[model samples]
Target chain A: MAAFALGWLALWELAARAGWISRLFFPPPTTILLTLGRMLVTGNLAPALALTLYRLALGVAIGAGSGALLGWLMGSSRSVRLALDPIVTALHPLPKLAIFPIFLVLLGIGEASKVALVALTAFFPMVINTLAGVQQIDTTHWEAAANYGARGRALLQRIILPGSLPLVLVGLRLAVNGALMVTIAVEMLSAREGLGALIWLAWQTLRTEELYAVLLVIGVLGLASNSLLELTSQRLLPWKGET
Target chain B: MQITYRIAKYLKVVLAVLLLAACTPIGEPATPTPAPVLVRVGVLPFMSNAILKIADAEGFFVEQGLTVELVPFRSSNDFVPLLLQGELDVAAPALTAGFFNAIARGGNVKIALPLTAFTPQDCPVVVVLARKSDVEAGKYASPAQWKGATIGISLAGAQGLPGYVVDLFLRQAGLTAQDVTLTALDPAVQGEALRSQQVDLLYAAEPWITRLLAGDDVVVLSRAEDVAPDLTSSFMVYGPSLLAEPEVGRRFATAYLNAVRQYHEGKTPRNVELVAEYAGLETELVQQVCWSDIPLDGAVNVDSIMLYQEWLHDLGLLDRLLSADEFLATGFVEVPE
Candidate 1:
């Protein structure tokens, strides 16, 4: 993987130096790295990265928690599912960014709106995944636990939750990624600081090298975050064969 | 049959070779003429873009021997980066802190032409707006009473032009930034914010101002010109590549100046019609909308730009003040004799 990436970068560097492409329009990897180093020394990237991660954490926590609870309820009950399925289907296809203006009016243009946007984006994926996870379980799991005199919380704790754990973990992972994507997007639209703001500002000021550096940081952070989630999910769901 | 086919193919090849030789020069190498310079201009769909649009519409660019492409941008915020990336050869975004910062950091972009200036006339460059309920309630009865009021701006802080309006207003009213709240709100929702009482006041430019005034509940408290007079708000900028080719830059300037002259020939019916068409407004609204004051010959005021930069530094928005020579592209604009 490293070799493949480096080979392409090397070719780009040669082409840039040979003047096949203008440096102003597309800076080489070396220039982007140098600019990234400068940004690090200036303390520009630290706070932005921290803020973006913070927003992602808060959003994912709120969204996944509420969505899992609601999805489990709907999955367990016929009337609840019938009532919410329509609303879910209608909202699922709608882009979250389009409703940002409404969010701004309701929540005000501050941390609240940004967090809400991220939460809202993550919410849909979590709801859909959790619902599917619960419904996918065989009725035998529920009946088996109830036969042992398990009732209410006991039945839920012993059967429904454990049976759905693997697929629910998948939902949580997807929701976290969704939350991060929404967080970055909202930050770009109206933030004073964040990786998204850094990217937008760099683009606005025509700092091509800085823009590419910030993009690289975001990409690495996203990969690391998704991998961390995968590791945690594996430990929690050992029967899933380290997936 | 086979022999005849082979003979015909060989004859065709021989004839093609002869034609090529006939087209070739016998002696000395041929000198190639340079290709015509193509300029990609970034413009906002606003009345302020009248000069550029007119130059394009009237064939002035073609007359000057330059091919110009005008790309419409939604905001000035998107203009600078594209210009710097060489995707755009020219742009005329407002003189915000971002532009100054780019220049201070040694970005190869320079102020090329003066696009518009806030004049002494009763032009509507910017205005302070208040809700009718707030006005009637005597909330901001006096300028000093503006304390503790929530003022919505399209962009807040030293980076935005409205921040200067806040500065001038506070200075006039004997207040400071700490005395009130300044929130960055979208101009699209500024009127709604006022009507809903989400914000106490706002600083907005024309069209929005005109649209908001059409409602019974909004009133103009003051004009930006009255507070900060004779200021050049926005101007054209060019990347280094455009400047490196002296003749291309001159031709662009010449064509632009001709349009500016036509714009300033005193808003006749035709001029009003052109403004209306470009700004996407009715002709009557165009007449009511105060046109920005620009120099007839399109010369940027370097001293005013210096003063603006000093103010930006004082506000802590700019790290360092760039000298006039460093900021301005001298000799780009040829003064009309």
Candidate 2:
């Protein structure tokens, strides 16, 4: 895969150098490599990479936590799910970004709004996943727990929750991806820093090569984060078969 | 379950650290470089990209011994920090130089050359609509008071420039941003927003404005250039490194001037092709972005810069307003005789 990607890069550079693709449509890879090299050497990537990861982490943490709690409650209780599911459906489909002006008015165009957007997007997948995990708990396990005097917090925590772990992890992974994307989108939309902001900055200035470099940076970060999350889930749920 | 909860708790701590990092301010503030050889150029899509593409594709850059790179941006907000980081060579934003220069003291790249100058047709397009009852009022009521208005701007700069200028125009008669609530929409969504009565005013660049005006129904409120005559629709500026490179800057300028001459003389074809490709639109749409009636050479406009300086001061966008001479290099304003 790396070789293929590198080959693509070489082809692009050669095409640009050889005057095949419009250099305007695509600048040479050398320019991108040089720009990326300078940025890496100068340590500009640290703060941006750090900031993007931070937002992704915060959003996923808060969003996933609250989502799991809510989903568990709703899934364990039939009545609550019946009532709240409609509300969730109605709200989730509404464009998350339509509220930018409202946020600008209330939150004032700062980190609060960007963070809020990430959290909002994150909450959806996490909640859906958690609900699936909780709801799918085997009925036989509930009966078995009941036989042993398991009920309330103990039954819910030990039997029901453990059974739902795999489903919940699936949801969490989705939320993690959403969290990163929302952070970039919001930061790209407004905010003073981050990788998304870097991508946006490159476009406005017409640094074609640098633009691609920003994207490459984002791609690597995204791939690393997802793979890390996947590995952790696999390690923890050793018995779980792949869906 | 207990293990999961513990894992979640630990994850929260890790995530918190990352969130704060994204928000943390670091690196050198935007400022002029000690010296530079590389002519770092940042470009917006379409017109600016096309111009740069022409310079690159047609041996213009090679002729001038210039090395150029094109950067992609989703919008103007992304450009802000990039400009601040001194990562770009030049930035030709939809906004003026002062707004960018103000966000940080040193990291901000100042405007260099005005690669794009415009007249009525070359700038962003804004149309004001009303109930037939209101237009018949004929008293020119505040656009601010025109509640339930839908305005299309690509980003804040798109909304900010026209809305700010027009708001002032409306305020002269009695109004504020509070008076009329403006919903922001991108150009692709503008037509639906307008047709649905989701918006009363639509502000975007031409072909949209041109198509809207071509329609028999919608009323043209005012042209962008007429509203802000001294305002530049878009212009170019080198980042610190690019500005500091005398030879490259000089060569870049010369090539840019020649390209402008070719464009004006109708000697270029690929310029349009590049503009279309960069804009993620069709070739005809790119062709529609004709060089404004004003000059296209990379000559910095004094009055436009001064107007931007005033806007920045008024918007409290600057710590101290820098003079045109101070903000720009000789390469920017001087068209090399």
Candidate 3:
């Protein structure tokens, strides 16, 4: 896979360098790497990366916590599920980007609005996935827990949570990606410092090398974040491997 | 079950409202249109777009039997492609290399009107800002001290208006591109960056420039007009569809010129109020900043545009240089005798 990717990069570099493709629009990978080095040495990359991560972390935490809480409640109680299903179904289909202006207006065009947009984007998938996870658990598990005198929070902690852990992890993994995407998008739209804003600024100035470097950074961050989540899931759910 | 039904009913209503909102135009005609021609105008929420906003707000477009749909863009660079693709009937973009490159690539958009001309008095539209601490510390105090100073520009290289203006200042100061460090920073964050001491200087635009100047930690170093007086910065471009329909072009030019005339009446409370409402700035700030000179007849200086194009071509950013006659649509706005 690495070889194939490198081969593709080499082809792109040749195309750009040979003038088959305009270097003004898409600089070669070597040029992008050199630009990346300059950005790092100039102390531009660290602050932007740090700010983007900070926003993503807080946003996903807030969004996932609330989504999981609500999803679990809706899954456990028929009444709650019935009431929320209609609203969730209607909202989940709406594009999160479209409501960004409203968030900007309500939260002010600061860190708050960008964080809120990421939280909103992450919220939907987390809720939907966790809800599906909870619903997929057998009624037998619930009955067994109830027969053991495990009711309410006790039953939830012992059976419902553990049983649904696999699916919830999946949801969390998905939500992280969603949160990162929203974070970058909002930053691009209006931010002083972030990877997305860096990409936009580079594009506007016709700095194709800088643009590609930033894009590569974003891709690496996404891959690294997802891999971290997967590793955590593996450690926590050791029994899942056996199953 | 009853609660669930009620919630579902409410959800249905909300969904209906959202769908209806998605279908509605931003600037719908007040009177019912028997058959109104829909004109999608691509615009940024900037003071330079005061004429377009006025035309919409004052029913100038509606009076011409046009349903002007204002499509807001974050940057003019984002909409030039859309204009070429026929998604936007008209666009007012700052004369940047991106727009010229688009035109060089056979983009069908034509310069229909000149938007803003800079003068010494009205040059606050684009200005250089520096950290107050730097100024007080005697850093970047003179044009000769510009060497090694980190300058935050709003876009890549010297292709953007801010970059061009900054370059003009540097040249006048006997400095070259090697004398300074140019970082691509967004205007939205330039103020905070200045305050935090991340950048020593910033080339920024109004609203941001106005807001930065108001900050205790920032000071205006120079305005664009100081370096390049009477430099035409923005132009109104008509999409191929609009250019093909001469009647639509004529009506739009007439409506736009009407607003320009009103704006030229100069800083009346009513004009300031309209500009403030559109640019999302306070009325006081809008009044305080210098307003660029917009032609009443909506005619652009073709010679100036050609000079700008030649400069970009020489810079190698433009693949092809377009002739003024090929890129500009004349006769829409009558030239004054």
Q: After superposition, how far is residue A158 of candidate 1 from its true place, in Å?
A: 3.1
Lowest summed-lDDT stretch of 10 residues in model 3 chain B? Answer: B154-163
Best by DockQ: 1
Q: What is candidate 3's CA lDDT for residue B133?
A: 77
Worst 10 residues of 1 chain B by lDDT: B154-163
Going through the candidates in order, their DockQ values are 0.16, 0.03, 0.06
Ranking by TM-score: 1, 3, 2
For model 2, report the TM-score of its A chain: 0.93
Candidate 3 regions off by >4 Å?
A: A1-172, A175-243, B1-36, B62-65, B155-159, B310-316
How far out, in Å, is residue A161 in model 2?
Answer: 8.9
Clashing pairs in 1: none
RMSD per model, one decimal: 9.3, 23.1, 18.5
Model 1 Cα lDDT, one tens digit per residue, B1-337: 9999999999999999999999987986776755666899988888889778788878889888788988887777867666667789899876776677677655678888888776778557688899887788887789999898888886423255667767788889899878888766777677887777777888888778888998988998878888777677788888877878878888899898888888888678878887788878899888877788778766776777787677777865574788887767867676666
lDDT of 2 by residue, B1-337 (tens): 9999999999999999999998899898787644323455666554445667667677787776566667766555445445555677676665643344443334435665665554555444443443333355652364444444444444454334555665644555466555655554556555555655555666655556655545555555655565566455566665566656666766777777666666665524665665566667677655554444325646556776566566655654445667665666675435545
Q: Which docking class does model 1 fall in? A: incorrect
Off by over 4 Å in 2: A1-140, A144-243, B1-38, B76-86, B94-104, B120-152, B158-160, B171-174, B211-219, B266-271, B287-294, B331-337
The candidate that wins on TM-score is 1
Local error of candidate 2 at B304, Å? Answer: 3.2
